[model samples]
Target: MVNIPRLPTATQAPQRPKRTDKQRKAEQAAAPVSQPTVVAKAVAETIKDPAFIEEVQARVQYDSPQGKNKQALSAYLDVLHQAKREEYSHLLGVDFYV
Candidate 1:
């Protein structure tokens, strides 16, 4: 009778190195962060412009529903306008509430 060599089992498979907490943390820290959204940039630009508010005021009737929506948007733009350029500058990079 002929005898054949046995194949390697799972127990004999090569093992990979386990990552340390420091290495894991380093990898996480090295990851790139997300940038600001398009809406935020547009809001920032609108905040810098005075004519935008005037244009909204000119086109919308204060009593109508559509006008109310415009008013709300205009008010929010006003808030962004009144906010300190230095203090809220970081918020300009965000899409919504900062």
Candidate 2:
């Protein structure tokens, strides 16, 4: 039998340092501190606004016989139910269906 040359085994090479510890520490220190901004404060106020919530509820509840017969309301409800079921299933690992 003729002698066969041996192939080199695959191996991982040493990785180079991407960033130094001082650089990482400086970046961490320079990171933006979490504080509520004007937009965030406005959002919180809007959420707590009773009139806004009431208006939204009124719009959701205001349904005509024609709209109900056309399954528009039912379709919206079904979509909401499906989304909630999916969220619950992801959290609890249970089969959720409407």
Candidate 3:
């Protein structure tokens, strides 16, 4: 047998009226949401992989940007490759040339 007190005793604080699950959710939904700071929001956004979103956003029947952007990617890679080749070109002296 459990001994439950009908009212709060002097040592105990009075409990506020119990709210239903629906009431609690309603109150939460009604409350103003605290917006994240700029840096925090940027971090949260950058952490998310938006590739899937971008792939779907175009709503095209054909291939995604991955395949279509090969030209642009190749162009960038060519510039990078040229820079790296030039950096090591000095090491390839004419003495080593046949």
Candidate 4:
């Protein structure tokens, strides 16, 4: 008889137990509401200022990242716009995310 190496079967592999819907719901219910940090709030306030926006617009150089500059600029503009939306942010509900 020839000697054969033993191999583990699928059932022998470790498995992570899936959470039940009730467990998931319980976790969601236990989660705390999210809020912005002081630094983030300060940044939002600074960006909302017309003078700061103008300064940032003037300082943004397309040469910094070539073709990707537009996306970066749009993101920067979005951050500035966030200050205006801060009060209504919670209205986004479940879709809210970082």
Candidate 5:
């Protein structure tokens, strides 16, 4: 038999296990409720303001990702976390530390 070149074994970074919907909801529920911060309020207002949104849309030459803005999604999340979400962000995943 002719000699065949050996190939290196493929390797991949381990993926974090996916949490079930129940688990996600439980974690979200476990997250403590806190008062919205002034910065969070400002961000929500700026993103929700019709005039500001319109101005930005007008300025954008390319198409926007959202038809419904749905900007409220992120706005609400930031408000819920008191704008501290980034503090717990890591390479693998989030820790709900906030």
Candidate 6:
């Protein structure tokens, strides 16, 4: 047998009321202001680089092959070349023929 304390049903802490729509809207509107805009700026900067975009597209293609075929091998090699070129360009800060 377990001994349990019995208390008056009327003795309880008050619960917080649900937020009103206006209060919720105010909170949502204020939430984004403090976050740094650096992520958006970085994304914008990244998209503006054609080399980076090409490299990314190539990588996606290289990784998503449905079958092992000559075409797939050729495409994978092409993407690898593009990735190397992008890396070299980034290192030199300028395009150079290799």
State which candidate has the highest TM-score: 4
Error of 1 at 11 (Å): 32
Superior candidate under lDDT, 1 versus 6: 6
Alpha-carbon runs more than 4 Å astray in model 6:
1-14, 56-98
Candidate 4: which stretches are off by over 4 Å?
1-3, 6-11, 59-98
Rank the models by lDDT, top first.
2, 6, 4, 5, 1, 3
Count of clashing pairs, candidate 4: 0
RMSD of each: 21.4, 12.5, 17.8, 21.5, 27.1, 19.2
lDDT per residue for candidate 4 within 1-98, as digits (tens), equals: 45457954445568999999999999999999899999999999998899989998998876555567877887998898786667567665433345
lDDT (CA) per prediction = 0.76, 0.83, 0.72, 0.79, 0.77, 0.81
How high a TM-score does candidate 4 get? 0.42
Higher-TM-score candidate of 2 and 3: 2
C-alpha lDDT (0 to 100) for residue 76 of candidate 5: 69
Better of 3 and 6 by lDDT: 6
Worst 10-residue lDDT window for candidate 1 reads 89-98
Provide TM-scores for the models: 0.29, 0.35, 0.29, 0.42, 0.29, 0.32
- Residue 90, candidate 6: Cα error in Å is 57
* lDDT, model 5: 0.77
Model 1: per-residue Cα lDDT at residue 50: 90
The regions of model 2 sitting more than 4 angstroms off are 1-8, 13-30, 61-98
Per-residue lDDT of candidate 3, residues 48-73 (tens digit): 86985687667757553476498788
Q: Give the TM-score of candidate 3.
A: 0.29
- Please, what are the lDDT tens digits per residue for candidate 1 over residues 1-98? 34456954445568899999999999999999988899999999998899988898799865544767888987887788665644555666643343
* Candidate 6 lDDT by residue in tens digits, 14-98: 9999999999999999886666589998999999999999999887745444556767887778877998888889998999664
Which 10 consecutive positions of candidate 3 have the poorest summed lDDT? 89-98
Give residue 96's lDDT in candidate 3 (0 to 100).
Answer: 25
Question: What pairs collide in candidate 1?
Answer: none
**Comparing 2 and 6 by TM-score, which wins?**
2
Query: 26, model 4: CA deviation in Å?
Result: 0.8
